[model samples]
Target: MASAVKVLLIDDASLIRRLLGRVLNQDPLIEVVGEAENGQEGVELARTLQPQVIILDIEMPVMNGMEALPLLKKAAPKARIIMFSTLTESGARATLDALSAGADDYVTKPSNTGSFAATAGQINKQLAPMIKALAASATTYPSIRPHAEPKAAQQTVPDADHSWLTVTSDGAPEIVVVGVSTGGPQALQTFVPALPADLEVPVLIVQHMPAMFTRLLAERLDAQSAVKVGEATNGQVVKPGEVWFAPGGEHMYVTRQGENIVLTTDTAPPVNECRPAVDPLFESAVENFGSRVLGVMLTGMGNDGLAGSRLIKSVDGYVIVQDQASSVVWGMPGMVAKADLADQILPLNEIAPRVVDLLSTPRNRK
Candidate 1:
């Protein structure tokens, strides 16, 4: 049998630490190796224990999680770190900051911890799978290569594995729709900035996050990117040279109003357990743009985009995905790849350049 995943918990609250420890230990695949009350202690214990995963709280005295993050990384370079954050505005902002600062992922603390059993159940359900995924990926997965310049400016054909995808788009892409989760913030930080400012097609992204985090992410990415980036709003006109993220807690779609394609949002029931699911956006894109869709699937934890990718391909729309070696969790793109839906499978750094290449290609406009 595989050895249990080793985990270290760091939080200021004694009750939280106790509850987390109890719940995590109950999982047969997990073993709680240590606990710390603050980042300083966490860092020290990280050095000694070298646990596979570290769960660090954002708000703590005597060295907050953010302050100790780099230190913990330095002390235990191989360990994957998951931040524990609140579900408030500050928590959302801090979680985004942590993700950009190299934290693998995060889980929000329960707002009402009034019932020990309920809180513990939430922790177990939310945290254990995350811990296992992160730890397994860290120990068994290859190290992520630093983002670098695209190797070639010219468009490249799909690899032999994708030779079955003989059909190609008949027209230059009119819109780019991206579906990402888990490691999305970090991936988008590498991707969005690389897109040229004069891109002729608007880009729509669905990154699984809460409402505040999605808005904050758009704002943050816009600050760094040459192209305009913001959260998608109802009735906004979709135009070239801008990037829009689906706001958390809502599914964003596109509709044709007269001659203009406009963005739309709805509170429809969650698909695939996600409010801003990729399927709805992809399906809507196909409906609005027909064969002019370009679907890009980045690193994420589940197969949310698989169905959408299928829709894109059925109409000869192009679909590309982040390759396994470059993914934080290969589940999303892996599913599409396995199903032969991707026209191209690329690393995070190359996705932007490839999109630009595909968009620039001279194809018949139908």
Candidate 2:
């Protein structure tokens, strides 16, 4: 049998540590190796234990998760860190910050359901699978991807090797739709900024996250990216040179109103077990733009975007996915690739330039 995944729990609350330890230990595939009450202790224990996974809490005395993050990385470079955050606004902001700062993923603390069993259930549901997934990739993929260069230095010039760009039977894309989860925040940081500021088509994105996190993600991307980025609003008009993300806990789709395409969000039932799932966003983009849509699937878990990719290809719309080498988790992109749905499977860094190339080409729009 395979060895159990080693896990370390770090939180200020003794209850949280105890709960995590007990819950995680119940799994024969996971072993709780150590526990710490603060970031300082966590760092020390991480260095000594060299656990495969570290569950870190954001708010703690002596050393908060943010403060200890870099130190933990330095101490145990191979371990994947998952942040423990609350479900509130501040927690959401801090979780985004942690993801950007090199944490692999995060799980929000259970809300005040006033039942210990419910809290434990929530933790097991959210954290256990994530721990296994992250640990599985720990030795294979780096905890943090290497930082990419600015847009000017990293431009992809097409050559004979780039023959895959001719697959689009549809006209040039009128709109770009992206579906990503898992390591999406970091991947977006690499992909979005590379887009030209004067892009002629608007970009729509669906990143699986909670309510406040999606808004914060939009704000952070907006601050760094040349293109305008904002969270999608129900009646917001979609325009070129701007990017909008689907609001969390809502399914965002596009609707054409006379001469304009507007983004619409609804509290519709979750698809693929995710509220802001990629499939809905991709399907909506195809509905509004027809064969003029470009579907880009970045690194994420699950096959949420598979059905949408199929629809995009049925109409000869182009679909590209981030290759496995550049993906933190290959589940989503892999599914599309395995089913032979993607037109091209490019690395994360190459996707932006390919997108630009496809958009710039003329199409036989009838």
Candidate 3:
């Protein structure tokens, strides 16, 4: 028989522990090997059990997640730790810090739904898939990816011998649209700040995140980047050299009105099960800029950008994707590459510089 995924649960509340156990036990392949009520106990449990996955809550007694994260990492270096955080500004900031400190990902803790049974269902809804995906990834070592994938951990660009659809295509780019999720916070920290301040086009992004977290991410990026970064506001005039992120839980779209392009946000139904989805934004860019748009798909889970990328390709708009080795989850970019929709597949470090070089190429204007 296959070995079950050993899990360690760490949260202050006894109720949460019991509820987590209820759902986790439902999965035949997952076994909750240990439970702890505080960071101090959690660290002890991790050192002893050496679980495959750790579900850690941010706020706790005897030591908070912030204090225990580094220690837990030290105790079990190979474990995939998923932080449980409240959906608030401070929580968002702390969660980002956890990610930087090597936490794999996080879950926004849901509010009480009156009864323990109802809340258990809610928790399972969010936690089940996340834990399963992480476990599967952990079981297969990073180096053991499929033959079609490039070195997933490598940071270098793929060889030039590969057939790429674009070196520099005809018209100068009028806009850049980015779709990223999962490892986006860290990836953006490195990538966005590297772009030139005097870039000739506006850049818009859709990052799958919550409300307070999106704003905090924008603020953090703005502080580090040469180009100003801000969360997209409805009816704002999309200006050159600025970076605008779609506010979480809303759908942001771009449209040309007269001589100026503008952004609009709405509470529309989600695409690919994400509110701030990549498809709507990419489709809008295709409608507005056509061949003058650059679509970038970065590290994320699921095939959120595949349709959008296909639409972009149909319009002669160029696309670039983060290669498998450097991605947190290669789902988005992998789909694009397999579909032959991407013009360039670059590592994280090479993407920004390539953008500048691509735009620098001479264009023939009508």
Q: Quick one: best TM-score, which candidate?
A: 1
Off by over 4 Å in 1: 138-168, 362-366
* Best by the lDDT measure: 1
* lDDT for position 256 in model 2: 85
Instruction: Decide which is better by lDDT, 1 or 2.
Output: 1
In TM-score terms, candidate 2 sits at: 0.89
lDDT of 3 by residue, 277-308 (tens): 99899988877776677888988777898888
Ranking by lDDT: 1, 2, 3
Q: Mind giving the per-residue lDDT tens digits that candidate 2 earns over 1-366?
A: 879999989999987777788888998999999999999999999999999999999999999999999999999998989989998899988998999999988888877535779877887778888888777753443222222311111112122132222233545788899999888999999999898899989999999898989889999989898999999999999888999999989999987899898999999999998898988888777666766888999988778998888777755677888987888778788787776677777889999988888788735211
**Candidate 1 on 25-64: residue-level lDDT in tens?**
9989999999999999999999999999999999999999
lDDT of all the models against the reference?
Answer: 0.85, 0.83, 0.81
Candidate 2 weakest ten by summed lDDT:
149-158
Error of 2 at 94 (Å): 1.8
Give the runs in model 3 whose Cα sits over 4 Å from its true position: 1-3, 138-169, 362-366
The count of residue-pair clashes in candidate 3 stands at: 1
